[model samples]
Target: MWNPLDSITVRTFLILIGGTMLSGALVFTLAGTERKNLESHLRTHHAAERIEQAIQLLDSAPQASRQAIAQVYANYGLRVDLAPTVGVVGQAPDSEITQELRQQLGSDRPIEIVDQENKDCPAFTGPHPEDKPHCISVFTALKDGTRIKLDVARHDHPPPPFRGNFMRDLITFMAGLAVFAWIVALMTTRPLRQLARAANALGSNLKHPPLAETPGPREVREASIAFNRMQASIQSYIQERTFMLSAIAHDLQTPLTRLRLRLEKVSDPALRTALVADLTVTQSLVREGLDYAHTITTDEPFELVDIDSLTEALCNDAIDAGSEITFDGTSNTTIWGSPLALRRCISNLMDNAVKYGQFAHVSVQKSAGKALISVIDGGEGIPAHDLEKVFQPFHRLEDSRSRESGGTGLGLTIARIIAERHQGRIILKNMGVAELGLVAVLELPLAPSN
Candidate 1:
């Protein structure tokens, strides 16, 4: 399941190296073809000149020395021999090789190649066939009026083959390219690291500065700009929601107070008791709404707090409220957080456990640079499917629907929101190992006490 190519660095390195090799090969191949073309053109014209000159020089020599003169030219890749014929039986006057050679030679004398062999053509298709050398028969009259055929054969010039230092140079270039690709991969990764750090800082503190719009490549710069815009949108949304909730709370509280006073004047004791109870429940729901909104909009700055003592005070307060709650573990730690929000989060957890299960057990500990607090209770555990749904605002479980149970159904929602606001997570699960119960675990990032 793990693949090296899945890594960004490996992928980038491989792509760069492959592209460099392919491009280099393409360039070298094209250049080699053109170079061979030009070399063959020059070789054809030069061979024509040398063949003609060698024939004339040899013919002008003394009759006894002509043979030695021919041997000297033959050793220099030009083989000269005498043929009996002064002309071919029938053929074109100017072949492709002759036309090109005549242009350089500037001789009006009829010129013909041996089977048209010394012509310029692509390397794949040669001017001469293998196993038989192209014998150039230059039929010309010497200055002494002697007619003879000079049969000349020159070996095809081949380019230097790949070997020795040629191979070493090619291999060195490839190795250097691979190193360059790795450096490019490293250069590309730093921008991503900066982006990640900025995002994490934004999550921990909403007031984090925006990322520079032009700090990296185009894609990274655009992503950072989008992140900054999204953060601003979220901040604005929270402010707008808090203002709306403030107006609603103020408008609704005055009517509820008047209704409570009016109900106190009812003649029948049973009727007044029931009405006042309903009014109190409505008030509790309104207060819970305000609490949830505050969780979203609170601008509380974090401070160093003794978490152990904070949770201790919450447990003591729950006991005073006639809840059967016990603190079962010690965190013995200090953390950076808003003291009021953390206390509210823990108090909600304890209230849920004690109200639903008749008793609450609380524990806290430090694990892997995180502070974890778990509130557990002994009761008929919620069904597996309903564990997460209970955290939704105004969503109550079927068993706790009676008015006498007295919940505004926003306790768990507010607690989870507060945890997230502090860069933490809250999860509810059935605690089934030893008893039929549930546990609400809140895990918060551990901050330095300083």
Candidate 2:
């Protein structure tokens, strides 16, 4: 049931196992220093005891029985010999092995310590199966005029060079860690990718379905549920507001008509003209208000729309209406959105430009897989402080471009809403050169290519 390829599980297990291994290794290393000291004491103590026993037996036994005694000790893996003391190396090496042997052997029974370079030194054999070239040997003269040699050897051959089982185990651990990391990455990233896709789709499609609760951690499930509820709340609020505005607009229509009929009967031409203008302005505001509400509530199906041709046609329409609206440039691409909504968003911007600048320049370009449509105008650019304020519904700057000049102020607001519904946004900036113009940029995300 174990999947080595599953990245999340593998990573989790490796981190768990690696931390355990590291802790174990650290403890072993720390204890190794103490262990070494105990091992040295035991070695020296054991060797000194064995040599003392050999010395006692040889010294107490008769000359004829010495060989028999040595042979008996040899059976226990210790070699003892009664050899002549000719060319005996005198001084011992200044090391713990020498010092321990001397202290245990005692000053009264001082023995000859074998020098390492002495060619005649005994070829010592140890209890281990492997052979060792280095060891310590002691020599003592017996009371009967014969000398005996005692040898103690330790296993000191370095473990065979590192290319055997060690390399294989190291490679195995690294492979396991890599697999664990891979598995962990896939586990976390897959769910996160799903969340990202859902988030991206939400901006363009309010009716997009809620994210399904997946078989994952509780945190991820909770986050998905929260996102769904938030989306539903926003959609509900928009629908309710739109219904209220539409009802109000429909109710006011009859009253507006009766007022128009009554005003038509007035005989004062100048006064009637002023009243009619005011009434017309009110009617325009109310109509635009209803339109704004509809824009938010309307959920049109997205369709393929050619951006270049759309901008060119809008330019022509403005030109026909006796406006200096020119197509500066265009890109070759198609977008996916409500064609009516996108056209209206761009048209509103163009109308705004001409109303203030007396001219409008439109262009379309693609960058980083997104389409950018810019509406530039030669109007006295908005004050830096009032730029954002102008986007509020029914908000207007009190300059020559005032509300009296026939603007609902919902133009920018509606344009912003449409842009956002297409998963894009709009930004306004003052044009270069004396800041005499304003540039309204609409950025729209392009449809994914199949």
Candidate 3:
């Protein structure tokens, strides 16, 4: 199964989300605690003031009517009652609410505040489902010595519940983070992708234009500059090598011609014939070396060429030269390529097949959007191990092929170079044990439609 996390962009986005969410969680927790503390402080301050007002009301009222006034205050979420003496047990802890109450109501008279645990205030009701029932009692003596008990139930104004808004806000946060992370990842990786594409094309097209050093991050711009420099270096090296080979081949021609003439003047006919043959072989090697160098650095422009016609012309020329060769089939396929380069490539394949195998069968056909020109020979096929090795410069199987057959061992090498220049390839394969020949298939992509 394909994984999205395999891509750098997805991984970066996920990492941003994880870190942001973790940081947000810590911030929300701390903020929530501070907010709850503030609300509790405000509620305690307001409760203290109300308790002070209620005590004053009981102190000024007639003794018999004081209970009636206390009962009237019970309806507003506070419980109140009257007694003859202090009725509560247990001491109250010194807390914020107790201190605030003592400060608001003077310390002249005896006053007691007791927290009643595991007790419910039946006279008052709470508004929230999560609210627990609890009560606090404050006992103090009135001016007439009548004891008054004030019960304050636990009431709090909690922050509103999240309900559906929690999910909506959560989704919004993640979606926003994802978009921002995606943009960041894409910006970081685009130049790297462009550099990779240029590197791959450099193998097939060294003379291709250099990458643009567009404005971007410092690291990406630096990478582009480095890549362009490397390309220029490689192109300069290939040009220098090609020029050196061409120069050597051109310089040897005059000496080779003079040697051929001098060998013809030998007194003995057999000796002269042998000397001339040697000179001819040396000239052929020089000429093929020059041709191979030309193939490497040709500046020919591409145009549409009919592959079938080119194959027929080469095959017919070989036949006219008294070589045992046959032409079969037609593809009517056209390709965009240099006509001279394509000719040299196909001629090398035909010459190799006929020279080594003694007879050659050439055919052309279109398959799978590519034009295939196959040349099969009549000679014994080469071993499977040496099939790819033959394409290397100056590589030959000496056991099966003799040097006398006249090859500088650069035919297949030159052919493959031209094929690759035109975005095509040549494959070599043995015909197996049953068939005693080698097959060379030149596969070229078809030209684009009009």
Best by lDDT: 3
| 1-450: candidate 1 lDDT, tens digit per residue | 899986787888888988888998899899889888777677666667786687657656886787787678655555454434434443343355677556654575555555435332112224443444444556655555555555555445567657569888988888888889999987887677677888887775566788888765788878888888998997788678777976797678899999999999999999999999999988888888888877766768888878778888899888898888999677777778899999989999998888888899898898878888989988777899988888898898778644577787889988987787778989888878665498999998877752
Candidate 2 on 1-450: residue-level lDDT in tens? 966756554566667567756875788667765677676667667767888778877878888898898887766545676885454444564476666766766666657666443333334455444343444567776766576776555344333335468779867876886676656656766777777788888776667788898778988989888888988998798778788988898788889989988998889999899888888887888888887988877888889888989989989988998999889676687889999999889998998998887788899999888889999998888888888887888888888457568887888999998998888899998887563489999998887751
- For model 1, the local distance difference test gives 0.75
Q: What are the TM-scores, per candidate, against the unseen true structure? A: 0.72, 0.70, 0.77
Error of 2 at 305 (Å): 1.2
Q: Per-residue CA lDDT of candidate 3, range 384-435, in tens?
A: 8888999998787896555677777888999999998888899998877454
Residue 319 in model 3: lDDT: 95
Kindly indicate the candidate among 2 and 3 with the higher lDDT.
Answer: 3
- Once fitted onto the true fold, the runs of candidate 2 whose alpha carbons sit more than 4 angstroms away are 1-149, 155-172, 189-200, 385-389, 434-436, 447-450
The predicted structure with the larger lDDT, 1 or 3, is: 3
TM-score of 1: 0.72
Off by over 4 Å in 1: 1-22, 42-46, 83-97, 104-234, 254-273, 306-309, 329-334, 379-390, 398-404, 431-434, 448-450
Model 3 spans > 4 angstroms off: 1-14, 17-66, 69-73, 84-119, 122-127, 131-151, 155-161, 164-166, 169-173, 265-280, 319-333, 355-389, 398-402, 427-433, 436-443
- Residue-pair clashes per candidate: 0, 8, 0
